[model samples]
Target: MRERQPCVYILASGRHGTLYIGVTSDLLARLVQHREGLLKGFTSRYGVIRLAWFEMADTMAAAITREKQLKKWNRDWKCRLIERCNPEWDDLAISLGLPPLRTIEGTR
Candidate 1:
């Protein structure tokens, strides 16, 4: 199997809406879970499934540390970070080497 990518991601309902910071090796799979509401709790309840921002890391520890740090960040700082890499806040599924939502919309 291919090696996993360590990444930190920020999901949000929309601009200036609820935000969720996370780290995962399987970003694509995790995103799918979020989209499907399979991972309940904070994200599902707040509808924070939009892929707003992310950063690639070389190791899981780095990604986790970044995630923890980001979680402690104030909202304004987090928004600034997201805007830096994803000004438009587009869905980042493709960047993570995942198929587009169009490909999944009709299937189970």
Candidate 2:
């Protein structure tokens, strides 16, 4: 079995688009759920399926704290944060071996 690694992540609808911040113990599984539209809520409703940014935490508590902090951040600050690591705002899930997400017309 794989050891659990907590992570704080940000999802986006597109570059400079709607953003959602969350924390998960299994990043890959969570990303897959979001990508497949299985987890119903803000992300599914807004089409925020692209993995824009992420950070690993020492523990689930730490990841949750960081997620709260990011959630409170303003849009500009959040965008800058994502840009620092992913300038193009590309779907980071692809880097994790998941297939590239299909682009929906007008979502960008």
Off by over 4 Å in 1: 1-3, 94-108
| Overall lDDT per candidate, in order of appearance | 0.83, 0.90
Q: On residues 1-108, what C-alpha lDDT tens digit does candidate 2 reach at each position?
A: 134699999999899988999999999999999988999999999989999999999989999999999888899999999999999999998888899886567453
Q: List residue ranges in candidate 2 displaced over 4 A.
A: 1-3, 106-108
Model 1, CA-based lDDT: 0.83
Of candidate 2, the 10-residue stretch with the lowest lDDT total is: 99-108
Q: TM-score for model 1? A: 0.83
Steric overlap count per candidate: 0, 0
lDDT of 2 at 46: 92
Itemize residue pairs with steric clashes in candidate 2: none
Index of the highest-lDDT prediction? 2
